[model samples]
Target: MGNYKWHPRFLNPPRYRKENSQLNIHLWNIMKARVSTNVEKVYERLRVIVS
Candidate 1:
C-alpha cells in the first residue's frame, strides 16, 4: 500500500493521500492492528478501510 501511494510507483492515483491528515491517521490506525497478531482484528481493520 505504501509502495503504490509513493512517487514513481503507482500506474494510477492513490486512493488516499498523505497530505490529507485524515488518510494518514486512518492508515496509521489500520497498521497498528498488525501488532496484535490476530486475523480477526486485521479483518476488522479491512472492514474499516472499505467502508
Candidate 2:
C-alpha cells in the first residue's frame, strides 16, 4: 500500500516529463488488470471451498 503511494514519483521520474501521461496510464492499466484477475481467482477458490 505504501509502495502504491510512491508509484507516481517512481514511474514519472524527473527525466521524462513528456512521456509520463502515457507511461502512467499503461502501468496503471496493467496493475488494475492484475488486481482484477487475482480477485477473480480468489473468488473462484472460495466458491469451490464453500461448495
Candidate 3:
C-alpha cells in the first residue's frame, strides 16, 4: 500500500468561493442519476437544491 498525506486546503476549503464545491455537486448529480429509481424525481430535487 502507498502512504498518503492530506493537504491543508483539502481539510479547510476557502469560504465564499466554489472551486472544489462544483466538482462535488457534479459528482452528486451523477451518483443520483445512477441509483435513482425515478430519474426525473432526482432531477427535480437537484433543481430545487441548486436553484
Candidate 4:
C-alpha cells in the first residue's frame, strides 16, 4: 500500500470556484423547469439538504 499525505486545506479546498459557478447555473435552470411544471417537491428537498 502506498502512503497518502492528507492536507486539511486541500481536502475541502475552495479551488473549484469556476466549476461551482457553472454548476449553480445548471441547477438554477433545472429548478426553473421544475417550478414551471409544478413539481417543486424534489427541488424543495434538495434545497433543504443544500442549506
Candidate 5:
C-alpha cells in the first residue's frame, strides 16, 4: 500500500462555484428524502410488532 499526500490541486475551489453549489444542494435534498423514508418504514414495522 502506498501512502498518498494531500494534493494542492484538490484543495482549490471549483471554477463554477454557483452551479456546483446548486447541484450539491439538490443532491443533499435527495439524500435526506431517502434517509427519512427508510426511517419511517422501520418505525412502522416496530409499531406493528408492538401492537
Candidate 6:
C-alpha cells in the first residue's frame, strides 16, 4: 500500500448529529442500527464526538 496515514479523527463517529441533518435519512437509519447493539463504549465515544 502507499504511505497513507490513518487518521482516526477523519473517520465518522457513530452518533445522531443534528448538524448533519442534511444527510440521507436512510444512511442514518443504518448508522443507528450499527450503534444500537452491545456497543455502549463506542456509542458513548461517538456521543462525545457529536456533542
Estimated TM-score for each candidate: 0.33, 0.65, 0.38, 0.41, 0.67, 0.29
Model 3 poorest 10 in a row by lDDT: 1-10
How accurate locally is residue 8 in candidate 4, as Cα lDDT from 0 to 100? Answer: 51
lDDT tens per residue, model 6, 1-51: 343323443235466576564464567688887777649878889999999
lDDT of 2 by residue, 1-51 (tens): 668756766766667666676877788899999999999999999999999
lDDT of 3 by residue, 1-51 (tens): 233224555435566358567875677688777777587778999999999
Write out the backbone clash pairs for model 2: none
lDDT of 5 by residue, 1-51 (tens): 233323543333446577776876687699899999999999999999999
Alpha-carbon runs more than 4 Å astray in model 5: 1-16
Which parts of model 1 are misplaced by more than 4 Å? 1-19, 38-51
Query: Highest lDDT among the candidates is held by which one?
Result: 2
Least well predicted 10-residue stretch by lDDT in candidate 1: 5-14
Clashing pairs in 1: none
Clashing pairs in 5: none
Q: Each candidate: what lDDT?
A: 0.66, 0.82, 0.67, 0.67, 0.72, 0.62
Query: Candidate 4, after superposition: displacement of residue 40 in Å?
Result: 12
Ranking by TM-score: 5, 2, 4, 3, 1, 6
In model 6, the worst 10-residue window by lDDT is 2-11
Whole-model alpha-carbon lDDT for candidate 6 = 0.62
Which run of 10 residues does model 2 get worst, by summed lDDT?
10-19
For candidate 3, report its TM-score: 0.38
lDDT of 3: 0.67
* Better by lDDT, candidate 5 or 4: 5
1 versus 6: better lDDT goes to: 1
Which candidate gets the maximum TM-score versus the true structure? Answer: 5
Tens-digit lDDT track for model 4 on 1-51? 233324554335567687775875687689788787776677788899999
